[model samples]
Target: MPSKTSIFLTGATGAVLTRLLNHPSSNTFDITVLVRNADKANILRTKFGIKTVVGTHQELDKVESLAEGAHVVINLAEADNVPFMKAILSGLRKRQAKLGDPPLLIHTSGTGLLADDARGEYITDVIYDDLNVEQYKSIPDTAVHRNVDLLVINADIEGYARTYIIPPSTIYGIAKHALVDAGVSNPHSIQIPVIIEASLARKHAGVVGKGKSFWPDVHIDDIADLYVVLYDTIVANPENVGHGWEGLFFGENGEHSWYQISKAIGEAMVTLGICTGPEPTPFTKEETEKYFGSEQWGWYSSILPREPGACLGMEADVHH
Candidate 1:
């Protein structure tokens, strides 16, 4: 019998990673995860029966060691870390030299790279197409996650690894998996939880400015499935999929304005007796900074106009 494909995974406790582990296809691969917490690593080991390496992304040598041993590397750790990316690529480069063949890398990026500075005041009409290689290559270097993204692209260009990038939009919905059900993994996502927490804090749902700026969104399940689909394709025919700039794939179902999201949150808050009414108010700058933090202000204020182009060929199961 053929041996199981060895895979190295990061961000294993995340919603997407948890869901990916729950997929049936995952059982066919020899999966290993790098976890910072030794206790969480033990839980993942006991629950999923996969190899667990207890180390943080900051440990470049350990990261390189793991990458060198794996047939494929799926990174969801941090999208903006250049040093971490360099470490992973270094290991993969060594693996290619030893095996005389390129390994596969599935990287997780974000739609924020395409976000426009509308500041929740206006909607920008510039939509980025993920399948258009030239368009993706044209994105300015100053974008949020562009530096690390360029590194991955350059690695692919150098022919050491077959790279595929999935840039997801605002992901929503609770994730269901053993780790999540066991309370070891977070079921909620980044953006939605911030909004929910702010609503609870102020006793009312609110939005940044006029909340006219919009962003594309996807259900957690849908985005996770996309990862699995890409993996399966790599397992079957890695050469068929696009790589480098051509590999940019946007994971989004539909777009939603911040006002609409706040309105929904308001209605939910009203039903739960957390707020007085089901109408959202615009938050002031002070409230925005206090509730969501100054760093995350762009998330609530910018317009991320992106549409899935390459992965659209497979037809994403939209749960929006």
Candidate 2:
């Protein structure tokens, strides 16, 4: 049977969750979002027309009652939201003992779970593929994620819910409600100011230090599509994996040098009408470092290598 209103999305109103809720397909499913307040959740329900369950994560034993007979539970639950999730999973299992079937639980995890740089490289396709998600769950650098991901993965074996983990890279998307200050500006939103200034001045946006420390990034639209892909897989088979997604993961300039990055930024500013004609002036490595406030600042210049021209158009086998 179609999950319909039986779907429960923890962190229903989270940033990524917020974007998912706004999609046109949201109405096609009878989604039940779990939040902490009836009033605020009610606003979401009124605005988005999804049911809301009010309770804290630690109070998730109460969630199963709210989720009775649910088919799928997509958790965008917070990183620290595990206490609530544990309670919910345990509670759901107990409820299922008397009720029959448990719901499918789609869990979220950080891709940073793969913390070991096998090649001492920031990130790369070979490095990414060499790391197993299951193995990644055990890496020491990702101790917290290991425990959380393990809990979700073992949910069914422990006799609660069927589970799936979505380990995401640096997620960049439009914000829903300025939930929290995200420290650094989203790279996609505004052109890097240094790049803009240098590009306009027609100079290189040089790397600040030894450019290293690769960061994985995906557009908000592509990230959202990853979920859509998951839903499609679920339609064909419930036991689908997200990291298995195939194709280009990064867009144009996924991997760029300080000079190259600056050039691209200058190019973008022109496209955005932020800068006219000339490329920006170059900054000395030290100057760049000073502007960025650390030798680490130069790391942004070193992007992971691009797969191929056409390949850049594809996304990673994120569903694996």
lDDT of 2 at 273: 73
lDDT of 1 by residue, 118-149 (tens): 65677765667776677788889997678888
lDDT tens digits by residue: candidate 2, 225-263:
665566557656755433322111222113332334445
Model 1: runs farther than 4 Å from truth?
A: 14-28, 295-320
Evaluate model 2: give its lDDT.
Answer: 0.48
Separate clash counts for every candidate: 0, 32
